[model samples]
Target: MISRRLGSIAIGLALLGGTGANALLAPSAEADATTSRTYESLKNGSFEADAGWSSFAQGAGTEAAVSDLRASHGQRSLRIVDSSSSSAVGWASNAIRVDPGKQYTATALSYVASGHAPLLYLKFYDSAGRELDSTATSASTQRGEWRAFPAVSAWAPDGATHAQVVIYSLSNRTGTFFVDAVDLAPGANASLTANQYFHVQNDGSATPWGWYELDDARQAGSVVPDPTDAANGVLAIRPHVSTGDEWSGAVGTRFSASEAARYSLSMKALRQRGTPVMHAALRYYDRHGEVIGTDRSGIDVVPGRWQESSLTSLAPSGTVEAELIIGCTGTVRCDTLVDDVTVTPHWDTTFYAAPSALGSADGSTPESAADYRDDAFWQEVDAALETGTARVVLTDGQYDVATDDDALHLRGIGSDDHRLLVSGESRFGVVLTQRADLTTYVVQVRDVVNLTVENIHLTADGTYVTPSAFLITEDPTAGERTEGIIVRGISLTDMPGVKYSGVGVAGTVPSGPGVVDVVVDDGLFARGGSGAGYHHVYATRGATTVRVSESVLQDSAGTYVKLRDNVGDWVIEDNIFVSSGTWINNVQFIQWALYNTTEPGNEFFSPGPYRIAGNVFEAQEGWCAPQCRVMTLTARGYNPVDHDGVEWDHLLDPVKREILMDESEGNIETRRAVVRQNFNLALDDAHGISVTDNEYRNIDTLMTLWNTSDYGAPSQGGNGVYDLSNLFATYRDGL
Candidate 1:
């Protein structure tokens, strides 16, 4: 007998007349169209028989079927197939119409009654009997247990356009089985929105739903919001401080905002005190949740009263959304109250440029404005110096000069804001030359003292080599002391071609002992010619009490900072030393030779003691030759060397040394030097130095007395040497 079925509508044909039948044709056009067409369940139900398993059943306004197929719980039902098979041979199957060359997801929910096979197979075939794609599942089934088996497959029927699923049962056959509740759906997957917030419920006794308290600068209240409700609920949030300690609101969503527009956000805040200033910051974020813009405002918070504050700023380029933060670091009394938060676009209207002055070089002076190389400016400056009231101001533009004489000889007159740029590229020689010939310049006290030079940037190209850059040589025949010269915020670079010092200042040769007090601050000294024997920045003889601070010196072969003989009372602080080389060396801080020989007293030495503080020393190995001595301090005098005169203090003591390194040891070699308190001396890479009051930890060699002027090894007196108190001899192999 031959049988055919179209879903739940089946047709059976029994070959009752002949044994040799060529073909049994049931020419029913309705059957052909119905069997070829696919059926999708619009409702949900169970299957009572094998034939019924292939039919679509509807229940409770939902489509369902029975073939051991099910959908994810709480999800909309689509299509399903169920199988009822207790043994391997008695497995049931189902057929469904599907589009050719399309993909579909089929799921099966089932459980074994009594047996456990290693695996189960699911096969697919076309209406003409060609195989498509096959899948399998592990075969450990329990009776009446339901499980969902999902398989995603693509159908490529050669010519036929429909496909069906076949279930292969295990070998053992036993109890009866039933299939129910299957589904199949279209489309890929779904995603959540940007502003969506999720919360998990914890069963409790208080309110049936989870709730917390809110305590901020502006207000104190309890939070009670339903987790199931997506809107109108308060969320617990924490704040972060980027610059100062203050609390502010955080952004809840990431929304794209245009860059060509401006955004302003307003919020209300309150404080506990009468009135206090609170910092409110609006931060912009991009699509990936990165901060891009920050707008800040100071809000006044009144006690128990809410005040509104608005912050405005241009929208950042490519900014989508941003968070707003409010905080206060002054006191806890300052609290931020936020309500009715609003964001909007900015609208404004006006623009203009300032008017230019007549006969003034408004940054439009040509490169050939003034002949810097000529002796004209300096000649006028020198003549004005005789009357003692000379001041030169060169505004914004470049100045060219070609002079064989002193560029600007300011005897007692001061020069400021004048970028005395010497640019002839070919006429390379000394830039500025100062002398102490008169008592004033421009009728304003020139040579007697008190001269100031500020806001000057000097540059020289290394294209040519000459005598020097700038020389401040005084005449000893004047029989007067030249003092008080403040040079602030000046930059000198690329003039390796000149000889002498890049910027030199020296006093009278032997004119009753000359004294020059100078201050050089915030300058950049770099790169000159090699073998020219040129130091980047130098101080010549008879210059005392010079302070050089907040400057950068780098990229030269010669010494970066140098002090000649008779120079004293120096403060070198807050400077960065880069490009490996000797930083400062040679010449004593306090030399007795210049005390009685040149001047009446030791005004030639640094005025009293000097200090070198807060400077960073960085060296690149093998590029520039490293200095053997990082810093050298000496007191070459016949007087008794005490803590009051020419004394060096090492700031790193035992505790400090231990904090800086795992271990250290050494005694610094300096005259009247005091090692600061709390430093560990007996650590690796801290040996062979001299410092006062250093702690030694498991150090094998306590002290090495070599070439000591006082005494030999075991009896060197007044030497700051402290041995390890708790000795561990077993680990003393390498010390």
Candidate 2:
């Protein structure tokens, strides 16, 4: 099962309000038909009304006022001046009624003329005047220029009855900042736009891009020159061992899916060497990252000739995604070549769309395919969902959602029960293009039960505006999260603005349930943002049980996958991480910061069952002058008082460290992981963790595992090891 072979350990992982004219406004011109784009902008959203907002200052020399010094989209802005050594200053809007469980995105423009970063918060309160919950965005980082401040997207908790938008900063130094165009809209930014748009275009080709070694180095798989035709390359699955597991020699790709549905699986394979028993199978997974069941090829292969195998089977119950495998098992040396692998919808209501097909199209077939550029296409999709699951099959062509304004190409699947599948002929066969900036996503999902976007290419020409290719998010209430989603078999290129995915899960609260049961498989995430915080796949604030496998991730400015704080139960396996690009903070290939940074005791503790097995980490020589690390499992925090008097030197003291672990339940940092059977090339070492049964080549130090808790410092002691081995890496000592 997936739990055994694929390394998946099952893990369990809005907004409000109302008002009249000031509380509810008409939909703007940019709002799409399906979106409840009607939003309640605070009476003083533009700071034009002097009486609707209350100003507060906590220090002697700090003050707030409506000033004409600068504005973004208005004649005036809220200015907070802190002339004292320490102060809290800003304006708070009157509380507005909100839906108890809906998400709201708090946005504003800020000019941090000097001093520290600004802060934006959406504070939720219950009907009894008691605070329920509050969420904040990243501190505003831009200075001088009037730029969009960080987002404070969050859900109104179960008891919340009102929400107040607070724009302020608690600074310890003298500074000034201006804020304008503030609004708290109900839903994510991408949820307010058209729900049927794509971001990049590709020259529809049947063959996908970026397939790499499947088994790390055991039974290698790569795109090698075709044995039949040297000029062309084919996927070569070479089984080095004569015999092993039933699914040993394999080449595979993964994609997101829905449960209890039949999928059409097919592939062309040729035996280039030994008479190995060719095998093809489909491994299905639940949103919890656990393997549910599998389906295999029904017919046997005819050796020494190209043969095609196809099968139809129902996906096991609870399956949200699946991997398509092509390979062989043998008692002797074997080599197999594969091509034209595909998995398409079999029982869902299917529609066809093509770029050039227009004129009263019905989307019944390719000849009558709906024109993707027309409103009718979206209407067609929106209508189909009123009944059951729907599949939109796109013909090979470029589908661009071009808009002149900064408005996002927000597309969401509307149903909470039925699934929606948007499939292309191949990963490079169909393309989705968006002309908007980084604030937008190629595909954004919120509150959907099951949705899959696969076999397509997403690109941004040179626009560094889109931060992710696919983003699954929701500011969910307690005990709820956006779940059962997949993004598979696609290519993301020239996406310099993407700080998250090829596929990312964002906007989750550390206190609330986060996005879970998500899978990102068989895609190419390359040449992305080189910014300090940018990464290929980023799961933040309680996201857990996510599986990222069988894909190529290359040239990230930062690391490939970043599970930042309170994320756990991630299965990252059988993928290739190629580091040959601009290096800003390329410190770790896959970093897991899985401990609670602010919470005391074990309230918000989330260590891990993080499985990092059967993968390859490769880097170019001199890419990171002193050499980069393969992976890191550390905390993004210092001593937070849970271990009151423990000093750096006392970390090694058994009694002291034991007290630290006991009081905190070892939640200060990443305390568990499985790092085995991996191939590290040109990687110098790992931090707070060691490896076993893994091959290393061209490494600087043979291998060094630090046993420290002070952010992987070599001089400190560790708390304990949480993996299967004797020494799991943590803060200060062994576990």
Candidate 3:
């Protein structure tokens, strides 16, 4: 269903990282594995205090102050009101000391009611309080409503120190923009040593967060928190620049200052995303304040790469104190961060997330205003879709599909907590029933490039009249067809109260600039009653690849997956199918290839040279009637109804009213495929087919090579039966 849902299966890429909670914590020497940790460094950064900050505003209005105005998170946010009549003007903050090379993040929450007017940026300064460079957030505010802006970033330079955070309006744009929660800090942990690794250890040591900047061997830079680069925003040490010392960069605290015969050190460093020519140095000092060793090791890396550097050096006999120092020197003016610096006597090689910043533990989630089946729910869904790429999660419950036009539309779902959006202990929610008579499909994906839907379950309202729960159809107006789609971690079961089980087609894609890959993995599709294409998955549009693996199918009509045109594919392996129905196949591939229904004969698209292996096919012995064939390949150009007068054609009524399915013809050689390494005794019969290395049991037919060309005949091999991937390894014992 390239026009509808047929296409290649493309995996929706992973979502972004979790909040600070998702950040890594440095590992403790005593623990067997790395642990997660978080720390707060902002000093009155919440705008709750008036003494720590100097606020001002400029432009036509020329007014700014910390007020009890609408807050972004906590109470009392900073409000900047400007006028359009005046020239561009703004306010600035007093300089905060920072060490060169130690990367610091500057972050602030901003809100603009109108167009992309006022912009917020950061300014860095050296020892004498001279300006060094200006940096900005990843993207500028667009003309929109009130919402939070992305985190801004910056890195300090060597000889360069001190920074002033500022906000202002450029020409042609002047409006009210609010700023709150300004935070600055290092982005990660670069190494692990004696210093408690990012303040995460509770090993009876104070977190050496306090750092000092030195010019000519004396302390110089003032310390403040950098808020922009850390997730959303966090606190950091801002050391003053001392041009006097090439090493006048920011310096971290001394954990386990008591020296040893040998010392090993490591830490992570980075600058802005694309800045070039940046460097950092790690130094070691002996007792009596004497320099013993310094690592001028060349740091050749791109910005924001978080490159880790390690060095081991032997100390003098009298080494009483050791100071691990970090300095930055780069021709490129970009914001940098230094995190997870470690000094250890023992060299332990390993990788770990930054223990300093929080990782995936903010514990905040999008609050649901309404259930997923309501108009309010669709409105929320529509808003997320507008972002081009969005992350959405459906909580557990039974939802409804009213009118056919009201199917749920999806674009993208974020990475973290997509499944955790549930309130308590529910697997997923499903569209159970339809409110309107015109409603056929429960979910119809129209036009999108790459999409992923996972960790969700579908349930019916127990209404027997309901057709399918999910369907992807053609949109004549959409020039861009879907390329890749992944549907995983889903489940559909018979309802407790319903009379006739709900029947659903699950999904389909259109034909045009057809589909590339459609993957259905790790799901359960059971008893979607006895309708047409109402089993697991059915695709019409020709897909370059179609994959279904690691799933379970039970209590459904005979046919399971009917996705044709899966060219050159991985095995449809590791599945369990227990059915009692007397159908031609548990798996079938037919050429319904309809490129453009409005057109005549469409070009032939090869479905697959598929490898169907590693599965357990059990046609329950008690259900009666003739045993169903495990695999069937037909070269038919039209939908079939088992020739017998008894077997009904459930697809006729639905297709007749919708698309012109009768007008399209497919390639006669669409029956090409392979089946091997399966435990099923029932062999499929078709042209250009290969069924080999399988076990035969209480079944009739072994191979039925009937019509079609380019098929691989089944090869004979092993006779033992086993399930795929040991999903059923201990299954019988559990039973």
Candidate 4:
């Protein structure tokens, strides 16, 4: 026998979207396609309960029990109080069952007694009787009123065909539990939308998104959301500029689109004050986050209004996934509001041509495109050269030249994209030389003044005995000054056993300060014979103000870059010199001298100012050779003895012999040289030279003054002695 007590009650109802109070019914098994239902219930007193279920009060004995309610007219009254007892306890014999592989929502009409709270506990079990998940509802009201208690739970079934749903009381206090109009059913379809809700702030304090912003703008915002709703939200951004700041921002949209699909994006922007520059960019990234496709366009925005900008281009090859970024960068103070973002995919119909090949200029020659003498293509270039407006493009391939005086020349024309491949073993490679003194090769332009020379290979089979593989000469008699000459992105190699210099650029006297602003970037100069004795690449007289940066000069017998007396204001930066036989013993790697100036009177006179910074001079581990000197200033030709009766001002201070040893101050001596911050020298062998402020790191001996000539003893004023700051030594070691 069991008895139940009366508990507390609370009631409230929320109308969903002004719908009627039509209760939802349990969905039928055949209604599995759509999990939604509606129903209505009538009030009745014919409550019903199955046999073997019992209820009782906690203080009452088992004999005193409550009776089960019976159903009448399809309705029943779930009595809260069968007896006026302190606490109610109830139990059912059989477990409630549910179907597997389905989700159900259960609700009950329940109320509790006054001063007694009632909580609903729901326990779910698998078909194998294992508990999956359990939850409890909040305490109901203690008022004496009937209320609808809607409790819903979702369950996923395993392999079992049946599951149990147990509903029980969680509190041990005295209360009445009334339940009626119970219903269980499945849930509806689940779908999600894509929206850009996240913000990316560009504060200009770090790299990445922040770095993309203008220096003046404090920050920018971006958002990323689910892909489904990606087409819904507007990517709105504001580009603001202060008095001393720049405005910039980049917004990137990531997606996986078809490789062959042509996509375009259009943006509408509103500007506030100054002229605004906005750019729309499309970029594709692979799984490794490498850029595979990129298209960009920009528009200027007028003050006080809105403007529209659009960019369209063919997606890069093999781009399966890509990111579309809109960037705003400029000094104008303006706000750009973007909207109406859309992506339309189309089929591509454009044809792609493979890169052109490199060959010789002789017609009717039976040779491969890579061969130096493929006359068909060379004739095309020669014809274009005659017009002075043809572009000769050489793709990355090997070309062999098999003639003595068969030179490759582009004279008095606007030719571009000339590439000479000079790497790897070959039966014979091309030798590109200037046949006429007035000829010049025009490479691609970079950074407004620099030019690009694609790979140039100068290889020769073991038979031909040539003096030089490639040469550029300017005759003073002709009075020609080749201005804006740049040789970048070319690999030049001299074949083994070549006696002459591999490449030479020589200028004759007085074409008015001759070749100016010559640059060589990203090139490899390797393998020349010792008999050349000058340079793998030599810049002779009148080649002024040259820069050799970002190149590797290795495995050469002579100097890498040699500039004579006429070359001034030269810069050799960020270059790697490895396995070179020996530099010019007479002149330093960088030299300055006043030609024909007498010593004593011309001691302070320097031929030119050359800055040799950020270069690495390394010796191969077991190679025994003298370490390279930074610079050698020669006063040999212009000494006081050679001049007439005029005494040269001693630039070398007799009082500061240690500082005057290398005369490094002369390089920066006049304060005209900008040697503020740089790494200049490093050598394995320690010669007795005082390397002043150029910091040396991890060196065993910081500064050694070798006693070649007994200028003094090992003391402060002694010439052979060395005084070094530990700070200078530690700094050099780190480098």
How do the residues 425-515 of candidate 1 rate in per-residue lDDT, one tens digit apiece? 2111112222212121101112434444544444542244444454444556654555555554444555545454555666654454655
Question: What's the best-to-worst order under TM-score?
Answer: 2, 4, 3, 1
Give the Cα lDDT of each candidate.
0.36, 0.55, 0.40, 0.38
User: So what's the TM-score on candidate 3?
Assistant: 0.37
Model 3: per-residue lDDT, tens digit, 1-735? 001110121111111011121111211121011011111222234443232234332445556766676754334567766666545544444345554444566666677754454555665555554456666552246533444445555555544546655555554455677776565655443222222222221223222334555345534343223445443122233333334334435555543222222456666666554334333444555423677655455455556466777765544322335555555443323345556556655311111111111233121232322433344443444344333233344433445555565545442321121110111122222333444443345555555444555654445444534445655433435555554455655555542222222222122333355554556665656555454445465654345555666555555553565544223232465454545343323332211222212112122323234555544344433332433344433331222222132221111223222221221223111211111211111122222223322221122222222222112312122111111111111221212
- List residue ranges in candidate 1 displaced over 4 A: 1-391, 412-448, 479-481, 529-533, 580-607, 624-628, 634-735
For candidate 1, the per-residue lDDT at 645 reads 46
What lDDT tens digits, residue by residue, belong to model 2 across residues 1-735? 000110121110011211111111111121101111111334446553232355545458887887778865324688888887756666666556565445677777888888876677777766665566666664566688878766777766555556777766665556788887676766632211111011111234222232334464522233343545422234566655645555554434456557745677666677766764676777888766888997876346567787987787667658766876655555666677665555666645888878667545888887888776555566667677776677888888766645522221224344555667778853345766665564556666665546677777666656556666677787555344566677776666566776656567764564556676778876666667757567788887657667787666767777678776546567776565656434453545776554423323121223244566544455544455554565654432233222232222312335434433442444322212212211011121242223322212222221222223444333234455222222322212211
Instruction: List TM-scores for all candidates, in order.
Output: 0.32, 0.46, 0.37, 0.42
Q: Work out how many backbone clashes candidate 3 has.
A: 105
Candidate 1 lDDT trough over 10 residues, lowest sum: 15-24
Candidate 4, RMSD to the unseen true structure? 31.3
Question: lDDT score of model 4?
Answer: 0.38
Q: Model 4, stretches more than 4 Å misplaced?
A: 1-211, 215-237, 241-390, 395-398, 415-451, 463-468, 477-479, 494-500, 580-610, 621-626, 639-735
